[model samples]
Target: MTIREHNGVGKVTWKAEPDAHDYPAAASYLSLIAPGAQAGDLVGQLQTASLEHYKAKDMLRASGLPLLPPDNPHVAADLAKVKNNKALSPVLLIRGDLTLGIALQIADGYHRVCASYHLDENTDIPCRIADHPGSRVSALAAAVGGDLVNDSR
Candidate 1:
């Protein structure tokens, strides 16, 4: 989907795939929360995962993460990218395990997500998601013909 206005600027464009640098960024962030090896593993999964789309509001809700203010440096930079017609990279996510009370992890592109939210809460954000290795949610979902990554929300 195309977005016509963001912060009173030009249209929002999304990259067909995540930038090459995004994997390392995601691995760096994931390392803090998961084992280094597992972080690498998750990044690998994200690399091969199919692209998916979700509304900005739904991502924030599922992540249980507070939206970054538009004035935040990173967020502002992303807004500027939109203003300049630079395509933003697709977000990388680690699926949440509700049973274990783990909220979805925004492994990378939090600022971009916030920027998209600033544009429109209902804006569809492109994302690539991976299941947490230890989470049984994906397993159960697969068993029951449900999907853990591409949530309809």
Candidate 2:
């Protein structure tokens, strides 16, 4: 199925042809975020993010991350591991473009990102970015045949 957000209307479709079914609440949410976009276009691609060094503080600032570290115990443990240079893996991220401009959303490794930033403003964290619309509620709703309004809190 395909959906297009042109102007303000969400054109829900299947194989480029408009389907008769009404869009669920999740589709409505997607429509608002990805205006002037096709449903297929909204979920696009995944790639290994460029190995560029970014200032930790700047990255957190751009992402609107809190100054305090994560409260989760696992995150704290991971942070400690990372600080000790025991974390051999990099963080997973989804490249995001919101009202705050471009930022990297932590799909995984929030602790690592926070730890690296808090430890040193100059620290650079590695990331694997998924450059796509990053919204799958609509598709999930369609699959489950559930209304997002009722299913989602």
Q: Give me the candidate number with maximum lDDT.
A: 1
Tell me the tens digit of each residue's lDDT in model 2 across 1-153: 222222322221213211122123223433564563542233232121333334557667756777555556755675555444453244444445564365655544455556555455555554434443433643454677734342211
RMSD of each: 2.9, 18.3
Q: Lowest lDDT 10-mer window, candidate 1?
A: 1-10
Q: What's the TM for model 2? A: 0.46
Global CA lDDT computed for model 2: 0.44
- Where does model 2 exceed 4 Å of error? 1-50, 70-72, 98-103, 134-153
TM-score of each: 0.86, 0.46
For model 1, the superposed segments whose C-alpha errors exceed 4 Å read: 1-9, 141-153
lDDT of each: 0.87, 0.44
What is the overall TM-score of model 1 with all chains considered together?
0.86
Residue-level lDDT tens digits of model 1 in 1-153: 344454554578998889999999999999999999899988998999989888899899999999999999999999898878888999999988888888899999999999999988877888999988768966676688754555554
